[model samples]
Target: MSTEERLIESARALLWERGYTGTSPKAIQQRAGAGQGSMYHHFSGKPDLALAAIRRTAEEMRAEAEEQFSAPGTAVDRIGAYLRRERDVLRGCPIGRLTQDPDVMADPVLRAPVDETLAWLRGRLAEVLEEGCERGELVGAPDPRAVAATIVATLQGGYVLARAADSVQPFEQAVAGLLDFLAARVPTDHE
Candidate 1:
């Protein structure tokens, strides 16, 4: 990869591993195998590079979610696929973890992508739930927006629970519980 690409990627990894407050430009340069000159030549400073990394991570996350959302299946099926998709559960979410970083949350510029990505996920899920209701697949379902928020909370909270226990079972159980809830709402005629 080019020096710029290396720098951005290194920053991404470091930011996920270490929060904005912990990731130093020197550490990013060292991780990228780029010198100080190379880093500065390619970007203004740490914040600029970090923004690029954060945006890339957010974009990738959206694309991955869209894959499930656009797949040929019922809304619940699609959502189930997303929730069950393989992930590095112990490592926690790249974007969600950033929300815990005081520095990231304190800066509007740094927080924009994280906030936007989550809102987008919630909105997209709500749209899927609404579609299911319109199609008569999700019988007697709650409000789509509320359900969407619950789903997001469950997933994010699942990550925290998994990390806290140093096990993936909590995350798996949370997802399973959510799936069971949604399954119960599926109309028997549709099933």
Candidate 2:
């Protein structure tokens, strides 16, 4: 990869593994096998490079979600697919992790992509739920927007629970509980 690409990728990985405060420009340079000159030449500074990395990670997250959202299935099925998709559960979410970093959250430029990505996920999920309700699949379902928010919360919370316990069971149980809640809302005739 080019020096620029390497730098961005290294930053992305470091930012996920360590928080913004913990990932220094020197560490990123070392990981990328690029020198100080290369890093500065390609980007203005750490924040600039971090913005690029965060944006790339956010974009990847959206694309992955879209894959499940657009799949041929009912809304619940699609959502379940997303929840159960293979992930580095122990490592936690790349974008979600950024939310915990004070440095990232404090910087509007660094935080914008994180905020936008989450908002987009919630909105997209709400759209799917609304579609299901309109189709008579999700009978008597709660408000789509609220439910979408709940789903996002549950998923993020699940990550926290799993990480705290150092086990994936909590995450699995959390997801299963959510799936059950959603399934209960489905019309009996459709089940």
Per-residue lDDT over 84-108 for candidate 2, one digit per residue giving the tens place of the 0 to 100 score: 9999988999999999999999999
Give lDDT: candidate 1, residue 67. 98
Candidate 1 error regions (>4 Å): none
What is the Å distance of residue 7 in model 2 from its true position?
0.5
TM accuracy, model 1: 0.98
Candidate 2, residue 120: lDDT: 100
- Colliding pairs, model 2: none
Model 1, 9-43: lDDT tens per residue?
99999999998999999999999999999999989
Candidate 2, which segments miss by more than 4 Å at Cα? none
Candidate 1: clashing pairs of residues: none
